[model samples]
Target: MKFFTAVAFLTASVSAFTTMTPNKVASSNAMAFSQFSQQSALMAAKQVPHGGVLVNQMTDDKDAAIAKATVEIQASERQLCDVELIMNGGFSPLTGFMDEAAYNSVVENMALEDGTIFGLPVVYDTDDESLQPGTTILLKQGDLPIATVELTDKYVPNKVLECKQCYGTSELEHPGTLMVATERGKYYMGGKVTGLNTPVRDFPCKTPAEVREELPDDKDVVAFQCRNPVHRAHYELFTRALDDPLIGEGGIVLVHPTCGPTQADDIPGTTRYKTYEVLKEETANPRVVWEYLPYSMHMAGPREAIQHMIIRKNFGCTHFIIGRDMAGSKSSITGEDYYGAYDAQDIAKANAEKLGVTPVPSLNLVFTEEEGYTTADEAKEKGLSIQKLSGTKFRKMLRGGEDIPEWFAFKSVVKVLRENI
Candidate 1:
């Protein structure tokens, strides 16, 4: 019998896998997919991880053995995020949680053993020190059995090193740093996972395989990553990205939002999902696609930007939008930004060649009094009148029942925010 991994199905058109040699890392010039009008393109169509999409299917014979497992461990919310992405092929080429070696490699360098540019380390960390190496742990979320893992390696990690490498600082105020510094479990477990079923969620969560089917294979797809509600400027930025001359005609946008736990102050995932749903119906644009990811926001700035690119590649996106301070988070105590405004753009641009997904710098669109919406540069050059409303001001309007200008946001989106208030 022949076994086929999920990546095999995703990259069916290509027979040979392309590895990224150090020399392949070229200048960060992301071309619009349409510009590659040739008999063959440089990058492969589908981007899979180092080993391929790691899928662990349950064997018929092993079901009985799993049922008889002695130890049952409840999975934390973070671990469930890993389980959903791993099982759904979103985290392609990762079979399960990272082993100690893999974790250490990712911490020291953002690459796996074979030099795969993986951004973050995904591990099953728990404070349960008693879960021995030989134990068969049944991981469950809210009383629902999701996966079974045989603990092969259980060890403590250097938390300081992990945070410093991934987040660039170990400050307690920074959310990403805080997570690694304080929230994660002490002991990390590493092993293969036998997925039984995906945990149920209230919001719409689709796997990469499902999204690929919805996207047209021959057309250009640009992915927009967002955690906040889509304001008019944001909508303009991504939609206009497709209109760039370099981008061939008939390009569509994927409005992929991270509907998972983020900063403590950001809008709730459930609330954000409603806004996207309303906006999708209100705008009624066939060019824009909607999907939600269960990825927990690490706010690792540049590194996280690369992580988004890799995941979107597996989702069948040819291009990804890298905006100012993408995936940026702040320090709660000091109220300071963790990364520079353009750091993510620079990093993603540098790795665009190796990542396969072209990086489209997000347009800085602003509303003009006389000319609808235009890029900031265009507005300045043409001396057009521009209007602005800070997020704090918008929230005040929403709360005070003030009129939100049609130029700033969709009425439908406003309705969702107003209802929440």
Candidate 2:
């Protein structure tokens, strides 16, 4: 297989990083949040899974050390995202796909064998009966060999149970439920993965360790997660988070967007990346940082929020911004949301204390003709004239070549979206 020779140079390209002050503890009355008290100081280094060791399986340094007699298997897009995260230590602590024991534990209960919290069962599924226990397979995305997995177990998961347990519903209309029912194979393969290379991506994807190198050891990093382009309300919401008594002075906000596959109708990753780049350059908010995650959105709502918290903690974030209906998905057939609006915040808040990361709830910011932008509550308290734009209406305007007010979104972002469409 042809290898990516430039793997060694990936780290050199990362830009310089800045640090922000630690977040203030959430007040007792903070909505949908718990007061933060450091149980332990933030780790001097980034966190690893249960064993406190990063499972880096990449063999980029030595060609002769490569595994021989490997059985090649094609990987799907989601699996490819898993590979990149695993190899780059973005999914630190996970050496590879979950084995049967781990998978069963995660599925049945949101914990590992050792009772560590893990939201989803990261298993490798396949219909090929040829891949059995004790077989070693080279997982690939087309021609690129990304990792080698030594399969130790193969089992048929109870899809019905999984759909109910993990996603909270068995309805075929729910995207996650539908994925579990149809897209996934009948059997799952689990084992240790030895990374060969990271698949080439159109956008820059830095690993956890690389991002950690840029961050300061003593500073707190608040990460803002998004799957869509940022607009005026989003900008106001996150920037205001830093000013909250909960977030101490000098705290920085990391605009970390998922750049992998999302809902079929959502904006493309490349276009979103362009929008972020232009916004960062145009605004020049030194307190804000930019990064991208190669995560495949499961739209599992609350469980997915916990999953995101764990992932962000591994990425060296001290806090994560959790908005209403985080990672929430809807039923395509029924047009109804599967999870409650505050489900993610409630769940994440319940577990954030144990996860060692604080959950910063995003405020519902609105644009006002007089005040520019403010939280909805503040706007109402002051009786400011509020201006609103529905997402459906915004998309309609985009598709119709109608005017998108400057207050709603950046012109550069709109231009990119227009050009892409």
Candidate 3:
């Protein structure tokens, strides 16, 4: 049978096999239908959001929400990112900023009040202690109103406790801990949000529903989360993830990069987005789908992996690729890594089954003179000559106008970075 015809046959036979008794259906056809049914059920399970419901807080009447606002507050870049995700169902199971109960629960147990796993608390922070509950506030980007919140509760957050619990450390050296301690406001506000407009951004972030619509219903969708420009190794890693046994055949990888506020020193979102656009045009891979996510990075390592998985699950991804030291950061003073290399992979793997999303550990790939982009084990066994380039060296090369090896980075991506940086 032709490939398309075989698919049609399996789909058509599934229903018939379900209704037929034992020995009534042909054994070979029955086996094919059984496999097809399992795949269908798996895909169906992935479609369900983390909390079994996808939350949509976007308001149809923007004028009404604007008029109801008694106070206006300019949102920070991070807050804007959070608002976009919350409004678009990227932060499903979350209708708005977390209340005190929810915040405390997530900080203490990494879960919501209802025992639903939530990696971190999403709360609105402000220094204005005079703001009271039952008041309406409009959150804006500059003069443009983006979302409105009906304040239900306001409380001082335990910054140290939150940093320790969510990020595994309360040290000022840790970026996430530092952010919570110095950057966040004194008061944490909670309310249901009504989105008025999405912030103006260089890259348009698609809603979870929109992304889900583009994904294949019968094939597994593997999510690759990144905050930087895609390099050649990064390309090989995600593309190879499609061939993983967990993904099986006909699976596709979603190159979903966060085009929102990341580390202060990282590439600008606009520049990074441009690099992706150029690389996508250059490669034109059919098995890959590129999309942008408006999420602010926390550098919380293991905990952040859970957060990414939940968000991708809402976007209809069945699996997530967990790389070494995923979302990890370093100490500004000692320059020591905050989390272990395998910490994220371990935590993500531990929670994968419960989240309904499988965690695919990224291969430790290395570049060799004899064979390009082979697993570290294979290179070591063959005693191949390995090529290595550090990030510090790469940046220097970009500054010096040195030609970068195509094995280390893509030519198109290098061109964009060189021009932008």
TM-score of each candidate structure, all chains considered together: 0.86, 0.87, 0.89
Residues 243-331 of candidate 1: C-alpha lDDT, one tens digit per residue: 87646679888889998778778898888999999999888899999999898899999989988988888777888999999999878
Record all residue pairs in model 2 with backbone atoms less than 3 Å apart, i.e. clashing.
21-250, 24-246
Candidate 3, lDDT over the whole model: 0.81
Candidate 3, residues 82-149, lDDT tens digits: the string is 98888877887776787777787888988876677889888888878678877899999998999998
Give the per-residue lDDT of model 2 (tens digit) for 51-151. Answer: 24433557654344246535888888888888787666566556667766667677788876666677887878876867667777888777877788777
Residue 66 in model 1: lDDT: 75
For model 3, the superposed segments whose C-alpha errors exceed 4 Å read 1-46
**Cα RMSD (angstroms) for every candidate in the order listed:** 10.8, 11.9, 15.3
Best by TM-score: 3
Q: Rank the candidates by TM-score, best first.
A: 3, 2, 1
Best of the two (1, 3) by TM-score: 3
Best by lDDT: 3
Candidate 2 residues lying further than 4 Å off, grouped into runs, are 1-51, 61-66
Report the CA-based lDDT of candidate 1 relative to the real structure. 0.73
